[model samples]
Target: MTCKRALTAYPELLSRTVAAPSWVMPGTVRDNAIFLSGEVDEVGLCFFETAACLAYGENDLPEHLADLPLGWHVHLPGDLPWCDGGAEAAVPALRLMDKVAFLGAHRAVLHPPVGFADGAARLVAFVRAWEAAGRNPEDLCLENIRGEDLTGLWRTLCDLGCKVCLDMGHVLSYGQYGLLSLPGLSGRTSMLHANAPGPGGRHLSLDTLDGAGCGVGRAMCALLPDDAVVMVEVFDWEGVRRSLPLLETWFAAQR
Candidate 1:
């Protein structure tokens, strides 16, 4: 559905894809997003928030938005092993997801470390950690990314038994992005990231999408079932504002 309309749904669905690069942790960014999105459901966050949560060793999410109905998008922390050289951190990461799931949150948009394949090997470590903490496999969402060396990221996901969060812009980063397909997908996947492009794939703010990088969006929509979450991962408010029409068109096609 359209971003605007997704917000209008039952229990209230909001957008704002939180991301975590290797330099930062995912939970720290998530806490910031929660604090921000608490103001307006769609809070923008970086990928480091998860690590922040783990490092803090808090059993629950930051209580910033606890009073308000909560919705969270948690990017997985770290790269490679996901917890760096420390396997101890896995317990906390999975613990964090379980706590969020307990909140009955709208959904946690997981940016699966696009390591290699979205399959079993890469995901196995994370999956075991999550399950050990009592998290349902379905509660997590593995995400996709742009770039060539995405080894077994997807394969690890399948083995882990989790769904995906498809970022539209990352897929469209290349012309051949259209060639990729969303295979073996169920309606369980949700959330997205995109931005307006001025031309030459410039990642404009979220408020403006002139249909610059839209091919992957089409590919994702075709791959997914109806009623999935679409987080327009726009650069800023302006880009998000402009991309609405494009999302509307995409959502309309689903009908």
Candidate 2:
């Protein structure tokens, strides 16, 4: 059954947006976006593979992306070279941004390279490169991936004026509870990737969260800013549909 309560009905959640991935269905990005418009506040245009998506965006993307009546954001390529390419790594990102500029995407989620030395300096270079291209640095949100959290780059993230996209699953699976306690981090968080880690570290529906996982989710929800975007990061449509009402319940409990 569909969620009986409209998300807007919850006063505490009215200011926040609930989103779904663009590939929730087997059809094209536009197809999924249109279908999800009725179900979510935003549709995340996932450009998971930079080269292929850039080609698709440049050649085959519909002219009516801007016409879609929902908020939009992009999940940038997970393979971006923030560790090695430094400032030059922003080239592909800039290209992708230009491709979807018409959509007026509110944010871009990035999976920063982990375990690299001078990670902060490298990220600074990337920010400067993005700013040099006339993009807003704050729109680039660095997400916490598995095995490594954002604590190492927290200072750099703040200094560069970038935002945070905290992945709830990463915090729970990786035991990154310390991130929740980081001073001033909550104020800078603009997005939340809401999911639970299933077997083999794959993302599962929010309804699949166990007691401990739910506790972690509650803590994560507590830190959400009024303007934050909560992405139900599960990939398939069934998982997403199951998660939406559960997310609503989670948000309602926060009141």
Using Cα atoms with residue i matched to residue i, what is each candidate's TM-score against the true structure? 0.64, 0.92
How many pairs of residues in model 2 come into backbone collision?
0
lDDT of 2 at 114: 68
- Give each model's whole-structure lDDT: 0.48, 0.81
Q: Which ranges in model 2 have alpha carbons more than 4 Å from their true place?
A: 1-15, 57-60
lDDT score for residue 80 of model 2: 76
Report the poorest 10 consecutive residues by lDDT, candidate 1.
17-26
- lDDT (10s digit) by residue, model 1, range 26-80: 3443354443442234442333455555454343345554454434455555443
Best model number under TM-score: 2
Prediction 2 global C-alpha lDDT: 0.81
Candidate 2 on 1-255: residue-level lDDT in tens? 234133545544445688889988788887887677667788888888877888875324577766766788989997776656668778898888888878887579988766677767778888899889888889999998874588888887888899999998888788888888888988999999999888898889888988888878888888888899988898997897777666666777877
User: 203 in model 1: Cα distance from truth in Å?
Assistant: 4.7
Candidate 2 TM-score, C-alpha based? 0.92
Q: For residue 225, give model 2's deviation from the true position in Å.
A: 0.8
